[model samples]
Target chain A: MLRHAIALLSGGLFGSGLFISGMTDTAKVQGWLDVFGDWDPTLAFVMGGAMIPMALAWWMRSKRVTALTGEPLPPAPSKEIDTKLIVGSVLFGIGWGLAGLCPGPSIAALSYGGPGLYVFVAAMVTGMAIAPFVRARLDRAVPAE
Target chain B: MPIDWIWGLIGGLLIGTGGAVYLLGNGKIMGASGIIGGLVDGSGLNTKWERILFLLGVAVMPVVLYPLYRDVDTHITDNYWVLIAAGLLVGIGTRIANGCTSGHGVCGMSRLSVRGIVATCCYILAGGLGVILFRHILGVI
Candidate 1:
């Protein structure tokens, strides 16, 4: 029960960061995306600021054994790059350029109450739903490690 | 440019701190991507409440804050098709990469996973390309 509360609070704080960072605002994000026009480099600073906690969290976890849950936190797994990665990256770039939205921001935007966010979230969920099947089919065509 | 750095710092701290607590308390990595993905999988009854609440919190935050911080505008000017495409692409990317920015950039990076390091590099590269392609190559700017 307490664990669940902590998770929710953590997620809330993360979402709040996205909201406060102007990341949830499409225009601000689009401005960042518009590197050639105004070339708003502000998002870089936002990203840099955001990474601070991430770095600290990593450091803490790496040195520690048992977490607050009394369970050992394992190190992350490693994997090689493959075709799915390349193709998915290209598609992600195209989408990001076009919509000026990423997963965190898109999910964060839902709180703002807009039709676009709704559509975007729906599409995002649909894509997530379809990914496993697509990956399976692709994997069969080209066995990867 | 419009954002207040102090607010961002505070928010980041809270997020990081809370994430750490959750990690310590639950033995779970605070990765939003994995949580959301797990929710979709319908794993078990024990996790349902927490999953629903977490998602609800994510969805309700903006609405909760809109009244308090009325200065910022949430309006958008982009075309619908573009936004839809972008969302779909991000979904695919998250799956293919085995994680999203939250997973790789936040949780994975925190654990010092080599894959996290590589994935984050790819995320930044993709983001940079996205900025250049949209603003320069396409002249959307």
Candidate 2:
């Protein structure tokens, strides 16, 4: 119960942060990305500011074996840089540039209705659904290390 | 009105704190893509309820603040083709990469993960190229 509550609060905070920071606004996101055009630097500050607490959290993780909820800390992600990471990020970036919505903002912007919103999300989900198969093919060709 | 950097900073603090809470209390990385993506891909079945609850919180916050944020607009393109194409790329890209802005940008960078940093660079560069191609060159989106 406590774990669930904490998850809820964390997610709520994240969602609220996205909303308050104007991340839910696709224009703002596109504006930030539009450096050659009229760029908005607000997202830089958001990214910078967001790193503060998270950096501290990592420090805390280094010192503690267990979490506040008494759960063991999850393992850190692998350090290997691979083709999938680069290609996938590039693909994702193109989408983000085109639509100005990443995973978090896309989900957070759910209530902020627009016809394009649902369509974008549905297509995103479909892409996700098909990713495993695509990945399998890619792996067969060039085996991810 | 254009958003101020001050609000971005403030909201960023909240976002960071939220990540901290999830990390320190829940003992997990709060990658939005991975959280929801895993559920869709069937890898997160063991933690289904937790994922759902977290998503509920994410989805509900706007409604809770709807009174204050009544005029919020995403300004996304009305073109269905653009929307679908963009969405598909985002979905496939993030999944194949194994992270997104939240996972790689926020969580991974904070910890100085090499993969996170590399992925971030790749995406930002590609995004810039994409903007140039789609918006400036082709004038599609």
What are the candidates' individual DockQ scores?
A: 0.49, 0.83
TM-scores, in order shown? 0.84, 0.96
Q: Which lDDT tens digits does candidate 1 get at residues A81-143?
A: 677766665666566656667676677777564787788778777777777777788799889
Among these predictions, the greatest DockQ belongs to 2
Task: Put down candidate 2 lDDT per residue, B99-135, tens digits, no spaces.
Answer: 9998899999999999999999998888888888888
Off by over 4 Å in 2: B1-3
> Residue B72 of model 2: what lDDT?
83
Q: Per-residue lDDT of B24-114 in model 1, one digit per residue for the tens?
A: 6566766665566555544334676666666666666766777777445655544676666777777777776677666666666655666
Off by over 4 Å in 1: B2-6, B41-46, B110-112, B135-141
Scored by lDDT, the top model is 2
